[model samples]
Target: MAHPVDVHVGQKLKQIRTLRRHSQTDIAQRLGLSFQQIQKYEIGSNRIAASRLFELAQIFDVSPAYFFEGVNGANDSEVTPCNTSTTISKALAAIEDETVKTRIVTFIEDISGMAVGRQG
Candidate 1:
């Protein structure tokens, strides 16, 4: 089985790449690797070395910690709330539509205002 860290890293890489509107071929060309290699990295089939990870971080304009956002060094039996929150936050951050963000924020604000009005 692949390591959880690898899976998390791959997901983050894919998300960032997609957000930046980069194709596998583009990143492959920039990294001097084949498109298939990039695909493998994005799918967690390949474990990235520390130096290579740093290079990828540079290429994606993100910190190495970004790839490990949702990972906690916990046993399988232990549930880490931070990891779950991080995963949700990462997904939310990937949303690129400004109008969507504004709508969601306005909806939340309206709901909060209504709750406050009812309480007062």
Candidate 2:
């Protein structure tokens, strides 16, 4: 099984890569690696070393901290990705601003409560 942290990092990596319009081949070639290697890294099947992670951050024009930005406050000790709507993930993937993402989450939570209230 993949570690939760590894999985979280991989998901974030994929989101950022897609948001930046980077092909796996492009990232692999830039890193002198195979596309399969990049796929593995993006799927959490392979763990990225610190140095390589730094390189990826540079390639994406983000800080190394970018990968871990939304990890905390998930109401779980394990930093696994949230189990929400796919729409939410897609929406978040398009946004590079952490503050905006946080606001979106809050908005979703507020609306979700109203949905529950109506259902009840």
Candidate 3:
């Protein structure tokens, strides 16, 4: 069985790769590996070494810590490429200006008719 941490890391890899529009073959060529090897890394069938993880971080222009962003958060096992919440969170995180982020949040709330800061 794959370790949870490994799976989470792999999921992150796949997510960022997709967001950056990079194919498995692209990443594999950059790293001088086969696409199948990239596939295994993205599926958690094989664990990534620290050096390779650093290389990936460089390629994606994100910190290595990016892979572990929500590993300790609730419902981590449900994190996947298709998760809208995860996608939104990533988009929000990419925005450096707090004012822009707040406005975007307010816009989303307005369009969705969801009250911000209200919990059921």
Candidate 2 displacement at residue 89 in angstroms: 6.9
What lDDT score is found at residue 80 in candidate 1?
29
- Residues 11-49, candidate 2, lDDT per residue (tens digit)? 888887875668899999999999999999988889999
**What does candidate 3's lDDT look like per residue over 1-120, in tens digits?**
887778778888988887676889999999999999899997888999999999999999999998877776676564434357557767876888989988898888877888756653
In model 2, the worst 10-residue window by lDDT is: 80-89
Off by over 4 Å in 2: 73-77, 80-120
> Which candidate ranks first by TM-score, i.e. highest?
2
For candidate 3, the 10 contiguous residues with the lowest summed lDDT are 77-86
Off by over 4 Å in 3: 73-82, 85-120
Better-scoring candidate (TM-score), 1 or 3:
3
Full candidate order by TM-score, most accurate first:
2, 3, 1
Ranking by lDDT: 3, 2, 1
Q: Residues 37-89, candidate 1, lDDT per residue (tens digit)?
A: 88888777898889888988999888988877666667532222344444544
Highest-lDDT candidate: 3
The local lDDT score (0 to 100) that residue 48 gets in candidate 2 is 91
Global lDDT of each candidate: 0.73, 0.79, 0.83
